[model samples]
Target: MPPPPPTHADPPVLVIRPDSARTLGLAGDLWAFRDLLWSLADRDLRLRYRQTALGVAWVLLQPVLGALIFTFVFGVVAGLPSDGVPYFLFTFASLAGWALFAGILTRASGSLVQNSPLIAKVWFPRAVLPASTLPAALIDFLIALLLLGGMMAWAEVAPGIAILTVPLWVLALAMLALGLGLIGSALMVSYRDVQHILPVGVQLLLYASPVAYSASNVPERFLALYYLNPLAPLLEGLRASLLGTPMPPTNTIVWGATVALGTFVLGAAVFRRLERRFADVI
Candidate 1:
């Protein structure tokens, strides 16, 4: 009588289980997206060079122009001592590291907003966007390094075994840029004000850093507090490694590495946490 006893068959049961979200394995995710990362990097490279008249020449031009200006301002006008090294070579060497940091930070900070459509449409690890910028930055840094090499040769300042440590210093710079850039990327997504403020902040940071002069120029009384700025040791270490200047103390290197690593980890954590909301918000 009641639906013919349901035809003596059992009704379909919907088995609902708790939706256990899989935790992201950072290493695994990065590995999985390696190809995508390379593609994105290639795309960025092409876009950067597509319509530009100078193409890759822009890379060398930036540091060269920066060196010339700095030479005029700091070397000729201010008469800042380069610790006996030629002022042009000294400032250019420092610019090698500074440019890399600045370029990567600038690109990475704007990566999210620039790729808004991709962020909204695709479902990939957002970390790849910011990380992709490093390869191009590295390429530019290498070009600047070649110029630095020529300057050193002209100056007759041959490098020593300390040059072997150059890669480690570069790694430090990459970490610092990526870390700060990631934080900027996440913050820029929510607060558009960051888009306006970041450039000014980076400019202030450049003057605060010792790019235009030597770290030794900082008064000894403020040395302790000055080194607290992580870039101080990084720029100094790069110069020492490449040009035979005294290396930053071991403690400074350790502190710089600690700060860089901490910043990167914190940035990554924040990026991952905010990523889910990126599509909806952007």
Candidate 2:
């Protein structure tokens, strides 16, 4: 045993340290862990529909059901105007945009807490957990979009040339959701109240925005304050693009873009500030 004492010193250890110079190097860190991001997203996507009978069909079904309800409650009963477009088409178009925001916001907001086991056990960019939620939500949005296409054809309503700008509206909505999600997920680690509060907030927001009606229905006195909501104009813009309604004013578009992007940056900052404590607290 004495003679068997190791002749070589202990093996070298690899030291890991964070870059303090920039704690929130989101872009670089995300790129570095891109594979892990996709892995988490794929796992979620599979688990989401694993036991479901309808599977992805639910994506189409959900919005159809929601559109039907909105069409009935607001269009039929409330007698809300949908500008020149049929109320169902108008509501469906806006729901498409709303679903994108709602899906991403809800999923990403709960991501950190939902993945607490992995988060506690592993060391990776925490942002990836929230970011991973986006892919699955985006896939759902795309699936629902096919249904929208067929509905559009059936209605014989052609989107105008402004339809080319759909991507811009989508981007704005996504940015806003991601920003809000980042903040919500971070807060959720410290306070469970956020999860409870968020759904109520989203419900209130749904009614506040032009989900079942046109922006034109908003009284002129409330126009300025309404557009300040950011979602109002973007959703309106998206609906207009797809249903050939009038586009939101240029000023509102600029304001919404600014708010969306600014919120994203702010959320990233807040997440980074709180990230160091996530494993300890959650």
Return the top candidate by lDDT.
2
* CA lDDT scores, all candidates in order: 0.85, 0.88
lDDT of 1 by residue, 1-282 (tens): 445544212235534344422244554565668888889899998888889999878877889999999999999999998867888888999998998899889899999999999999987778888988989999888888888998899889988899998898899889889989998998988898998899998899898887888878989998888889899899989988888877777898899888988888888877777777788888
Best by TM-score: 2
Extract clashing residue pairs from model 1: none
lDDT of 2: 0.88
User: Could you tell me the TM-score of candidate 1?
Assistant: 0.90
lDDT of 2 by residue, 89-187 (tens): 899889989989998898999999999998889888899999999898788777777788888899898888988988889999999999999999999
Error (Å) of candidate 2 at residue 6 is 29
| Pairs clashing within candidate 2 | none
Q: What number of backbone clashes does candidate 1 have, counting pairs of residues 3 or more apart or in separate chains?
A: 0
